[model samples]
Target: MPTLVKRLLAALVIFLLLVVINQYMSKEGLFGFGVPSYYARLIVLAGINIILAVSLNLITGFTGQFSIGHAGFMAVGAYSSAYLTVYYAQAWERSLGGIVGGSLAHALIFLLAILVGAIVAALAGLIVGIPSLRLRGDYLAIVTLGFAEIIRIVILNIDSVGGATGFTVPGYANFLWVYAFAIITIVIVYNIVHSDAGRALVSIREDELAAEAMGINTTRYKVLAFVISSALAGMAGVLAGHYLSFLSTNDFQFIRSFEIIIMIVLGGMGSLTGAILGAIIITFLPELLRTLGPRLESLLSSIFGADNIPASVHTFLLQLANYRLVIFAALLILIMLTRPQGILGTREFGLSWLKRARRRPEGDKPVGTGGVSIAEQEPPSAIDRAKEVKNQ
Candidate 1:
């Protein structure tokens, strides 16, 4: 089959899957079965985090630039799009709803909002990248981090969007929209990584000075990666803001930026699949740990008999659960010590691994077979090739 047809089929399948998932996530059951709201919400948020992580990977991972201001771009997207939807979306939706169906109108408006958020975030990235990107190592990190805090502080004082209190906007995003964009972000980053520009970006990461010496225009590519990363982050923010139906400066705190950094680092800085895995782990790990206390208590009670278990022991177990963050930190430290390169270490998870597994070892083939043995197959030496060339 043609690649285009395959892509279209894949797209259709993904759309249908998302639709089924959205229905299951809704209050009303899909075919009498539905996921609990809590799980559904977690999945949606995880998708958003995936976008943020993968985009950050492009700049910091593939392009070799350290950036901690992703949350700032996210804030820019959230508030700017929120400002649009709050003040203008209704009128435009009503006007367009009459011409097109209500559903289409709402989607159109939200898409416009997403575009606005992305563009504005890209502009913010450009503004920040131009000056700060010139700096390298810890200085660049400090500048990006400072810029993120500055954006957060500035947003805190803007009363139009409710300032410190927060801003509420229409709920126009759901599982389908969020995941669709998440997939788009992944595809974008993947293509960019595999393309000529991706090669240039990787070159810059490997050695910026060497890339510049080769006339690769290091600064332009760095800024491009930064802008693209920022824009995708903004899009994630738009989805997040619209899905949550609220925007808060508190959500875009410096810690949030750090969390994004942690996702990429924990996953493997240069790996796309690693970023995604990291995002999922980061988003769900804390919640998963929430059950540890009760489970541990139950296990101890079963072993010692409930009557024999001391109140103090139970108290300690509960308290330990509360200290899960400390545990989480320890786990991260352990991972870093054992596998500092990260879970994947710049490798992707795919069918290629299977192909590698199927390959035969060199010299393993029988000599009697029609195929030439690896040990017997040889190329002409360099000297022989040079003599032949001279003779020719």
Candidate 2:
């Protein structure tokens, strides 16, 4: 089968799976049980994180730039979008009596906010990239890290935007908005990565001097990639802010940036499918761990006997809730030690193993056996026959 056809089929299958899952979630319940709202929130978070990871991969992974301030761009987007939505929504409500006054009007407002977020974030990327892209390695990382801290502090001091108390955004996010934007982000990044521009970015990653010698205009491509990545991060922030209906300076701190970096590293830095997988796994893992706390406590109690189990054991388990960051750091370190290439390495899931598995013919010979036809076989030469006779 043609590669295009195979890719289309795989995409169709993924789409179907997503549809089925969404339908199931929309129904009465799961296994005769009602799923909590927090699970849905987790799914939304996973989607947003996927966007962040995949977008950052374009810059840090494919383009070979070190960026540690992604959350700063996200902050720009969140604040910009929140400001537009809150102030405009209020103005529109006062003039037209609510978002329902006209669907078109409501949509226009929403689109305006999204565009503002993207533009603001892209500008922030440009500002940071102009000077920082001149540096490399640890220098660039430090510059970006400092930039993120500056953004946090600036937001903290901006009183009109809610200052230290934070701002309350209107709840306007749903599954539709979150997943639609996520899909858009993925599609845009995917197309860009496969384009000629993407080849230029990859060239820079391979060797900056070599790319420059080849007249590839490395700096231009680097800035472009950074801007695009930052814009997507901003969009993700907008989605998260709207969904949660709250925004705080603390929410976009450096720790959030580190979390995103960890996801990209753990997922295989250059692979989009890996980014999505990493995002989902990391997002749900903590929730899954939380669920196990009670079971672990009970198991320990049984093993040690209730009398032997100290009250501090329960207290310690409760403290595990506060130790999530430590666990995340430990997991990252373990992954780095055991599999530095990441869960999927630098290859995409759809590009290698999955594609091979799906496309292999049922009865085909093994790939490297060299199954020559009898007609192509040749008898031994006269020299060989003479040598055999001499040996005998």
TM-score of each: 0.90, 0.80
lDDT per residue for candidate 2 within 1-392, as digits (tens), equals 99999988987786676655554554365456544677877887898898899999999989989899999999999999999888776676555545356656665677778889999999999999988888888999999999988988998998878999999998776565677788888999889999999999999998999999999988889999999999999999888898899999888988898888888888888888888888887899887766565777888878987678778888887677677767866877898899998999888776355454566475664433256545565776999899999999
lDDT of each: 0.93, 0.84
Q: Where does candidate 1 clash, by residue pair?
A: none
- Which residue runs does candidate 1 get wrong by more than 4 Å? 302-304, 354-392
lDDT at 209, model 2:
96
| Best candidate (score: lDDT) | 1
